[model samples]
Target chain A: MNALLRNKLRAFLTMLGIIIGVASVIAMLGIGQGSKLSIQQQIAGMGLNLVTVVPGSQQRGGVQFGASTMQSLKETDVAAILSDCPAVLAASPEVRGNGQAVFGALNWPTSLYGENESYLQIRERSVTNGRMFTDRELSSAAKVCLMGQTVVKNLFGEGADPVGQVIRFKKIPFLVIGVLDSKGLNTFGQDQDDLILAPYTTVQKRVLAITWVQSIYTSAVDSKSTADAATQIEETVRRQHKIKASDQDDFTIRNQTELLSTFSSVSNILTILLGAIAGISLLVGGIGIMNIMYVSVTERTREIGLRMAIGGKGFDILLQFLTESILLSITGGIIGILLGIAASKIIGSTMGWPIVVLPSSEILSFAVCTVIGVFFGWYPARKAASLDPIDALRYE
Target chain B: MKKLIEIIKLKKDYYVGEVTVHALRGVDMVVNEGEFVAIMGASGSGKSTMLNIIGCLDKPTEGEYILDGISISSLSKNDLSGLRNQKLGFVFQTYNLLPRTNALDNVELPLLYNKTVKTKERIERAKSALESVGLSDRMHHKPNQLSGGQQQRVAIARSLVNDPVVILADEATGNLDTRTSYEIMALFQELNNKGKTIVFVTHEPDIARCATRNIIFKDGVILRESEVKDRINALEMLASIPLEAD
Candidate 1:
């Protein structure tokens, strides 16, 4: 304690590396954990026990157009999936488009998603303001629509009741029959609460000027059967398209299970990568501590000799120096954790990114810092302990 | 008087590359209790080497040293440190007090190495040691805050706190001015008079005259051993010279 206090500036500078290393590690891991959690939450918010089927790309003379351009999936395919796949509980045909919505003097650019009553059930979205489109409205292709929170805010004004009001999209006036509860944003940072939903028949006939649906949204009875539902849907779609054994299917079925697994694996790698990069900084910090400790041992050689001559054992000197180093690192670690949490909160609010300061990461970094202190402090402490008392006393 | 230190054919050598330098040839010495002994020699005469061996800070290359009946050469490193803590005290020419620490804390350091001493007892003992050295008022002052003489007094108090068998001083007055040297020697004479054994190394014959006995070294061996017939009173000598103002 006396030796370290003798040079306060050097001691603080020695602790600086540990501080920066721990802070960076905490901040990076916090951000990574926040992103991972946000992704999982977004996936959960999308739907439960869900699978999506889309038309495969169409090839003409070795030229391939994007998916959903082939028009190989239709409304009959959705019905066939619901009837043929026992694992499938519900399904909906969908046609999608993008257009500007106009109400009074306000205008908002939004996605026009065509879905049915079953789509709302499968999507787990509840109408907050008014009733949903009925079966009568679906068969007649009624031009009644539901608005998300963002559209209600932009076109109708915040907290405005737009139910029963007529809004114009693509020059066609549609009555607002319902409004959905806000879902905020998706994992991709796109606003999930910025779109409008209408019956698929209305979008295909009135908005898109088409007879074919582009995709189908289906749900299994429960989460555990989602994979089985996807397989059954795939086989049904392949049979409906009449593809031979050697030919490629015209549709592709995807399950939330596969998406979740892929996303989690990707995020796991990302978290590890961030941790490794931060760990490098920690390693550098440890090395800095070691270098400073070596210099301190050398500078205090005479002091060591004097202590030894006065009856201090080698173990005493070793413990003293080791305790000093550990104290330095642990102090830096605690301060760094506090700084990291503050920085993470600031970044979260400013950039609108989710920030999670995991307790596990905090404890782990603290433990690692202590270990680094011991590991780096060992060589210098040993050198100080093994110093010859005669030579040390004689050192100038 | 009981003998406190026994030395037999003490020898020390230094090797620089292929050449071996004999710092101390065959020599023997003993120190009895309540004695003020000065070992005098010019540089390269091995008085420092002899002092180091007697202080248990170094081992004789080819001899046996017994301190308070424990053979120094036969003892392990830890045992040597234990013996030093239990039975030996050291004062250096540099006034080697830990810098930036208060005088009381500096004095308490040697006692900290003694396991038998309790914490509360260590503080009380250190305070009395400083008081004995007439630095009770300067106990809280750091080494840099005190003058050269006061710092040496603190070092002396530190050596005495353990109540060792002997106090080994190496040129303890070498860094002081003339009056301060006389003052420090006066304190030493007082300590010796109180039944404390003292062995100090000095090159100055004037400093040796203050001791009751003198052993002069020349070329790695003792050349002469004699008693001081007229040991000057350090306090009377200081009174003859005018004291300087701060």
Candidate 2:
């Protein structure tokens, strides 16, 4: 221990690369873990209480295009399904189109969505200002619009309350009823917090002048009943569309739980890719340690021989070299861990991502450093051990 | 007294670029319980090779060497190390003490090899050996911290720590000046008088004259033998030799 400490510079030089390598693995892994966790939390915060279904078949030259031939779903179907499906706690149909809305002097072009009173319940959305449209307003096709927080901020200026004010959609007057809570940006980089919502009846009759609805959402009593409720709704919709089991349906039924699974699979693949990349860095560091150890053995050949001649055996020489290598690797591992943590923290704070340092990574990196020490330092130790005492003593 | 070391027809061979170099020709020799014998040879006479073989650092290619009744050829490496530790001591002209180690630690090394010697006993023995060599005041000094003569004394003290019967000194004064060389030779003579067997090698006639007996080697063979006069004690010889101020 005393002799080893005396050669501090040599030891430090040997460990330098290892420390950098380990630190890189740790920091990168931490950032990855943190980001994965944050994304999962963000998805969770979007609320799995809602489910959506979109059209998938074909319609000739209509707004439904070549995908769905018959647009079997409408506002009436949503009403019938809501009344027939007792498993469904609530349901709403949404219709979307490009439209220009003018409020006072500002004229903004945005995607306009039309929904019913149950839209907030089915979508798990909250109102930030004013109130949700009443059932009477939706049933009567009343001209009331719920603006997204982004729409309000962009068009109505900061701290502006546009509620109860009148706005025109394609020159038809509509009253601003409420504003949606901010949902930030999602994985596809789309702003969920930007867009406008109005009654489905109003959109079909007053805005788009179309009879077909685009999509529908339903909220179940709990997460466990989501699959059952989707099945029940799908059956009821198929009966209403008069489609047989052998033929493909016009619309698709989706559950939010399946989406959760899809997200996990993609993230898992990404995490593995990241881990492998970091592992390559560790391997590079291991090679660096090996190269330096070989040089050390060559430089200290005379000392090795001298030791053996006096009384040291082959094992003693092996131990000395082994100790030096391990010393280097362990010290480097410690430094790398610290650096990795600091880097992760910086990434987490700056990028608004979660940076979690998992325990397995710490253990894995330390073990990797040790294995690097043994594997790379072996050749030099063997070289030192096999040298003849007489020749070694003669070495300058 | 009893015979402590015996060498019979010992021949050590080496291969240098496909050419055979004979380091030791077939030779028979013995050193009794208490004797100081000097080996005199010119360069390439194989005196160092002979010393190395005697010191158990190497084994002869063919021949039997019996040290304290154990055949060196039959002993395993670890056993040979044990034999070297228990039976033989060595002194070199270069004062080959480990550079970073203090005098006390240098002397304590041989005792470390012997498990029977406890740490306390090793320390006491090392201190006594230093006192015997008149370097007790410099026990804590490393080799680089001491003068050439003082370093040689520490080496001498190291050789005596294990209390081996036979002490091998290969050109024990080859690296020092005349005055320092005589001072070392006087120390060897004193250890020899205290019933320790000395086997030293020297090329200079004056250095060879200090031993009680001298065996000359030439062409891998003994060419001459001289009976040295042992009438004077070591301190008297040390005093007679001229000295320069340190």
Model 1 alpha-carbon drift over 4 Å, by segment = A48-124, A132-162, A165-176, A181-254, B244-246
- TM-score (0 to 1) of chain B for each candidate: 0.97, 0.94
Question: Candidate 2 regions off by >4 Å?
Answer: A1-4, A25-51, A55-146, A163-178, A183-191, A197-251, A254-292, A344-362, B104-140, B160-165, B182-197, B205-213, B224-227, B242-246
Worst 10 residues of 2 chain B by lDDT: B229-238
Per-residue error for A261 in candidate 1, Å, reads 2.9
User: In candidate 1 chain B, what residue range of length 10 has the lowest lDDT sum?
Assistant: B237-246
Q: What is the TM-score of chain A in candidate 1?
A: 0.67
Tens digits of per-residue lDDT for model 1 on A1-396? 877788899888888889889988998998888888887767867874889998889899999887767888888898899889999999999899998999989998899999878977888888899989999999999999999999999998889999999999988999999999988876678888999999999999999999888889998998789989988998899898888989988877777776787887888888889989989998999999999999989988988998999999999999998998998899888888898889889989999989899999999999998999899999999999999887887788
What DockQ would you assign to candidate 1? 0.56
Number of clashing residue pairs in every model?
0, 9
